[model samples]
Target: MTTGFETDRISRRKAIWREIPAGIWALGFVSLLMDVSSEMIHALLPVYMVTVLGTSALTVGMIEGVAEATASITKMFSGALSDWLGKRKLLAALGYGLAAFTKPIFPLAPSVGWLIAARFIDRIGKGIRGAPRDALVADISPAHLRGASFGLRQSLDTIGAFFGPLLAIALMWLTANQFSAVFWIAVIPGFLSFVLILVAVREPKRPEGLRRIRMPFSRSELGRLGAAYWWVVAVAAVFTLARFSEAFLVLRAQSIGLPLMLVPAVLVIMNIAYAISAYPVGVLSDRIDRVTVLIVGLFLLLAADLLLAFAPGAIGLVLGVVLWGLHMGFTQGLLATLIADAAPAELRGTAFGMFNLVTGLALLIASVTAGALWDATGPQGTFLAGAVFTLLTLIGLLPVQTRLGKREAS
Candidate 1:
């Protein structure tokens, strides 16, 4: 016989699960498989480039920055096309397929140029899927469960993020640190992700009354997105600037005397924290004030930046990485939910495209800057710059935070 409290808790869990559409669950697993594929390679790429290929830190940074920017830029077109076609799953599958094909390239790269080309194509696939996939999630989800839905996807994604690194660590040991063998194993999951998406994901039918617009980017259509969506975009771009690429985190772990084989543990630890917290934070956002949650995330990033900047040993390094994960857990899903909340459903693909585009460009700049700073002043300087930018972002958020409070109060 369950106690009253236990029964109530069990019922609530069931209710939340019931609210999320099957498509979302399918999408979550698709993301989980894809992350597993990507992370296995990414967990080790930075070190592979630097130690094996003899690429400089700045060069590594530039590669990562460009790779991410390529993905972001691609989303603008893919997302707009999804809106025009009123079909998301096809484009999403195409993107995943492209990425799946690119997985083999990672193991074959004999030079930095080849590596760059492979990464570029892989990111292109990511760009193609990102906006439409997000918009689709928004489309399928009920309004009340929006936060939980995004959180669920993010949590599943982070599960891959951690698992990828864990596999890399295991393979490293098994192969006596043979990088190419692990890269080869990663290819399996990439194709699996594409198959899962095709079989499992069901896009919501276009609303019967929707005016199918040919020009998703026309000024009038853009105007329909309104001020609220743009505000979220601006703040997210600044946040992107503050955070830069996680490649730096891998490098940071290496800097603190972390062994080459053990470095994936940094991502493993961070993603564990991320996977655990994302759903809970999402549930919290649905219940309380979201801006407050965003602020909390920003502060966590601040702490992470500061900790990474001044940490004296391995313990400090791990702590900083955990804080970084916590910040990601708190804010990433919330931002997606906010975009869904702010945008008109018909224009959601465009809304997400524009949002990702701006932030993606910001990421490009931030990564380059971080790399340049590392070249000039070492790792400390890179993280210190991040701390300053995070502080600025907090100050910038004050007005937004105030308005959120007033709106709720009224």
Candidate 2:
């Protein structure tokens, strides 16, 4: 017989599933499949570029940085367009379709320039989909369940992140580490993600007789966005400055004596921690102060950076990677929920766009700097700089947390 505690747990799980809408679930799966496709390429990209294409660490950093920046910059326009058109699904589907088409370019590329072009196109697709898809989740979810909904989507996406590396590892073995061969398998999932979004997700109707909104951020629209939303965007940008691309993590592992075929395992391990912690931490955010949870995440990042900087060997790297993943789990969904909570319903897409744009620029700078530092001072110097940045972020968070706390209580 099931105990009372077990029955209660089951009932709560059922209630949560019932509370989240069908669209949210569908979007979560769409994110899942897309991440699977993207991570498969990403988990191997840095190593492939360095070893096979004869690129330097700085070049890898530059490519990854520029590619991500392209995505972020594109989001500004695509997100504004989604708000203007008042059609989230259409833009999101288009974004995914673009990414799907770009998948073939990775394997077919004969030179570094072609590879860079492919990455740029892929990130543009990501940029187009990112804001509208996030805004769609907010539009579909109830206010009280907002954190959980974002967390659920993040958890599923992270599951894909881990699965991609695992698949890459297997395929690497099967193909005897032919990078392009593994890339070919990624195309299947990319197309599947677009098809799922096209067939399964539906947009909510706008207010009756709404005007065709051509521009999302007129003075009136900006006023409606208020101060809180802008603050969240600032914090997100600072966090991005502290955390550079995960490509560095792969580089660190390779430098520390990991075989090329096993490099993907590093991402697998980090993402496993991310997937495990995301939903639970998201649930925790709903119960406690969101700022407090975010602070904890920041602390975890600091710890991860320090551990990586001073780590002795494989064991220390593993611990640091786990902490890094935990930090991602704790912060990412919480930040998204904060943006959704702060922004007005109609302007959410624009808000997310702005957030990503600033953060993306920050990431480009951070990654390039990290790459330069790594070349000059080695891995320890790179991670130590990250720790310093994380400390700065924590210090900056104090007043913002206090002010937000007072406003929340009031």
Candidate number of the best lDDT: 1
**In candidate 2, what are the lDDT values of residues 1-410, reduced to their tens digit?**
99999999889867876888888888989999998899889878998999998989999977876787789899988887888888888889999999999999989989999988889888899999999999999888887788888999999998998898778878999999999999999999999999999999988888676555656868877776777777777778878888998879999998899888677678789989999998878777887888889899999999999999998889988999999999999999999998887877778888888888888888878888999999999999999999988888777777667756655666
Decoy 2 TM-score against native: 0.88
lDDT of 2 at 275: 91
Give the Cα error of residue 353 in candidate 1, in Å: 1.0
TM-scores for all predictions:
0.88, 0.88
Q: For model 2, name the residue pairs that clash.
A: none
| Per-residue lDDT over 91-182 for candidate 1, one digit per residue giving the tens place of the 0 to 100 score | 89999999999899989988999988888999999999999999999999987888999999999999998888888888999999999999
Supply the global lDDT for candidate 1. 0.89
- The TM-score obtained by model 1 is 0.88
List per-candidate RMSD values in Å: 3.1, 3.0
lDDT of each: 0.89, 0.87
Off by over 4 Å in 1: 1-7, 44-63, 106-117, 176-180, 259-261, 375-381, 398-410
Query: Would you list the clashing residue pairs of candidate 1?
Result: none
